[model samples]
Target: MERTAPRPPPAVDPLRYRWVILGVATFTQAATAFFVQGIGAMGVHLQRDLDISTAQLGLLLSAAQFAPLLGFLVAGELLDRYNERWIVGTGATVVAAGLLLGSTAPGYASLLLVLLLVGAGYSTIQPGGTKSVASWFDPSRRGFAMGIRQAGLPLGAALSSAALPFLAGATSWRATLLAGGLVALLGAAVFMVFYRRPPHVTVPEDGPHLSLGAQLAARFGMVREPSMRKVLLSGLSLISVQCGVGILTVLYLYEKASLEAGAATLVLVASLGAGVAGRIVLAAWSDRVASRYTCVMTCMIAVIAGMAVLMTPLGREPVPASLTFVWLGFFGLGWYGPWLAYLTESAPPGKVGFALGMVMAVNQIAIVLVPPTLGLLKDLTGSYTPAWAVLTALTLATLAATAPAVAAVVSRQGLRRRPPYS
Candidate 1:
């Protein structure tokens, strides 16, 4: 009989595979973020067991954020040079290692050091995941895809918020660190095993690579653009609100609203749950709207309203306080989806990773500083009201500064045909 040709393997579908990438990216994001996101949930335990003040508690959280200040810039540069699968997977592994080490921490200072290492690892995930999603999805679906991917943060946060406190309450705070490490290890393994770059994209081997100084100059130049400046401002302001809410929600409810610890934690969970939903809904809405920036602005307005409500007499009541926090969570956390999509769209050609890294690095200044500042305000004033007032005023000031620029951009876009991404 005549020999038959061996059958060729079936080809993978790019469209179907993109969803796989999305799932992996989202899962890895959630897993890597599990411990950090749960810090707020552990506030009561950390304060009780460590015998630390609120400022110290805030400092503990800030420790995890501090390394990301410089790490994001480095990670961004790496993303532009390397494959995300390895960068993100390795980052998650580092997070696992840091958390595992943190479990053995003898005191507040040691825990802070461990979390600083964890923050270094976490710096890779945000820009790496954003760049990966943006590469797969075009403008029309980018916002929605970005939204789903970004939702992983709050999804992980919500799960951690619900689980960590219970774990800490049942065992000890150290056990919660161990649990977070294991989860991060699992996430790292999944991404390393499954993630692959889109098959169609190619890296050019013949192009001249820039020197370190030149590359740094080019990345810094992005800051000079009006649009980028706006993004930086918005990120700084809104992230302060986000961190404030996460750091203070349970404490505020427990101390000011007269709720029990368990009840206060449940409210934090509800707020994070709202954030997950808001990210998806608002990003999808951005897809239909004239501008993604509009969605971000809407979030700003909503956050201001929520904070204003929290400052009122009604915030003292359990029902009203819970409802208002949920509202704050929705807009404050949800804003990241549309805002990231906007940032990705705003990047100059061939520099998405660098732009993300640079802008996010600038934002980290707020993330690191705000938590401690808010905590100190609460400590000095002996009230949560001053902290809330500060966040409200910061956000309001940013809105006022950026409104005219955003409005002009919107008006200009309205007069012309809408771009696919914008």
Candidate 2:
């Protein structure tokens, strides 16, 4: 009998594949989040162009968030059962196409409808891209890997915040959306072409796919786990702070700090750039220290400190205010790096997608409720103080709730000994 020829190996080395996945995950994440985050930067233009109130503009951001409340769960389940490359790539395509179609939107209502579609597509990117990166890196380096991937959001947002206002000024809001859509499509193509599952992540053919009831039950069951409860609660309080910071930074600077529109937007871009750096640095620190919760606690402390500064009269001083907002941007967004790493580490085996989905889905509730509420508060009170104070209290609450977990990690000398999912 003739022997068959030996199978050729893949072009990239297995050892280097994880980094390649990280790069793709990062780009896709940045691309998917670009338009929504850019919306915050374009607030004044949207108000003038669309002739809508602050509340209505807030609603636009809220609209993008609304769909993720449920979409996250569905995407999570699909990720557990499907290939991430296609799920993520397809989702990005949807976002691009939706925005392309949205460019033709006739009114604020039509734009809202278009944003709804963008959110649906975004629902896939968080869990799918995260799960894909998590699969490639073991716990030892997962935090660092995840941080790099998550940084994509802020990095993309920073770039968009810096560019979209100019684009809108030169062209039209519709044209800006068209430009963002094109970037998102490019991201989708990159992810589809380059991403590959790790060799160790083979799916078993014999096991039955999770039934809907079983999947729902599994998700509910995650809520009951003690560690998961802490993670969920931490996310609940922390996400409000994150959303408030993201949505209100430019507005707050323009209105309260007496900055011109261009200067305020420049400040917003700088803050998001800080956030990009913060995610990577904080997550890398978590990996080195092997204490995800400690890193989270550190971030909470930083946020509280930053918020306290914001609450004072001194925070309104132009130079101080810009510095302070960037400080908050660091911790507010930085917390997510370690937070997500801990969440992934805590997940039960084969359930990273579900855990990430459920936790982030619940977090999305805060994202939905908080920004608009803060916007309304700003509208009603004619001040950002109430919003900043509320965020400060929320951060305090999250720190208090997560104390026990952080203490446990500290007691262990800041090292996790086992796979949290196991």
Candidate 3:
């Protein structure tokens, strides 16, 4: 039997043409990230306009998890087996509908419905975009590509930070939220038209193709492969902390400190600007670092440490809030990129979407659980200390436990898979 020559690699300057596809994907995610993170910026306004308690406000901000929390397992599996363009594009549309609903919503119940819809929409962006990008890029360049891609979150957050406050005043927060939805919807349309996997690549013909349940099983199997778990653990820890801060910090400023809403929101904007810097810098840092695993571990440690500094008397003290936001922005958001890189490297074939979606799922769970628990703590105790302590504990414990989990899995796998007679 004659062997066929290997298919030529796809075009080198993916930039000239492919970048549009990539950019569309990035912008969709950027839209979602901006809206999700900016809920904190809307904190003071939402509370006053709706007559909801702090706990209820927290529920509204955190409520955007319904889709991801419920739909993500399937979403991940779908991205792996199907063409990503439509998967993600549809997700963006779902998010847009939620945002459109939210803009006109009259009360908390309606707000909850819109947020749940939004979360569902946003969930598809990660797995779908990541699966598509991974198919196009090689491992060596994947980190850089993914870093640029992942910066979508920070970029989106920055845009939201800049736009939300101003738009809210001019047209109401409702209008601003709708603006975000429109952005995602636009990206989705662009994606559906332009985005397709490079045609040169081939899937195993005999293996599963686009079977939702089977793909999910494959993803679950991939995650069980110890190295992949390390990546997942790192992601779960980092994103939980990031979302916790993103959802709560602005309210913390107003409720704990005497800062006016305007002052508090500006501080959040500054912090988000710092986050944009942190994402880029840390992404670059991973390129220089010897081990993706170590870089992720180190960043998680730094972030946990940074959160402690933010919990200081600085809130009540005359110390500069800007300085604290800077530190938090660097140390808090910095953990994201390295861990994302680790995940991109470690996730198994056909399961990158699953891994990323799972990481996102953990983040959303944190989003759902953290703010309300914090709100409850405040409701009961009249302080933010308990919420801070809970997150600190969550980060510290996860950071410590992750290393050993990785080690155990690696050791067991090494023992199981070594050559029979080495």
Model 1 C-alpha lDDT per residue in residues 1-422, reported as the tens digit of each score: 99999998556787787888889889999999998888977999999999999878877767888888899989988887789889999999999999999999998999989999999999999999899998887777778899999988888877787799999999999999999999999999999988888877654321467876776787789888887887988898899999999889999999989999889988888898889888898887787777788888899999989988888999899999999999988899999988998999888767778899999999889877787788889989898989988888888998898889888877887834334642
- Candidate 3: Cα lDDT at 301: 71
lDDT of 3 by residue, 138-244 (tens): 54455555667777787676667667867776777688778877876787787787787775655432264658576446556776676776666666566666666
Model 1: pairs clashing at backbone N, Cα or C within 3 Å: none
Which numbered prediction scores highest in lDDT against the true structure? 1
TM-scores of the models, in the order given: 0.88, 0.89, 0.80
Q: Give the alpha carbon lDDT tens digit for every residue of 169-217 in model 2.
A: 8889999889889988998999999998887885533146777687578
The top-ranked prediction according to TM-score is 2
- Is candidate 1 or 2 superior in TM-score? 2
Any runs in candidate 2 off by more than 4 Å, and if so which?
1-11, 44-49, 204-211, 254-261, 381-383, 412-422
C-alpha RMSD for every candidate: 3.6, 3.3, 6.6
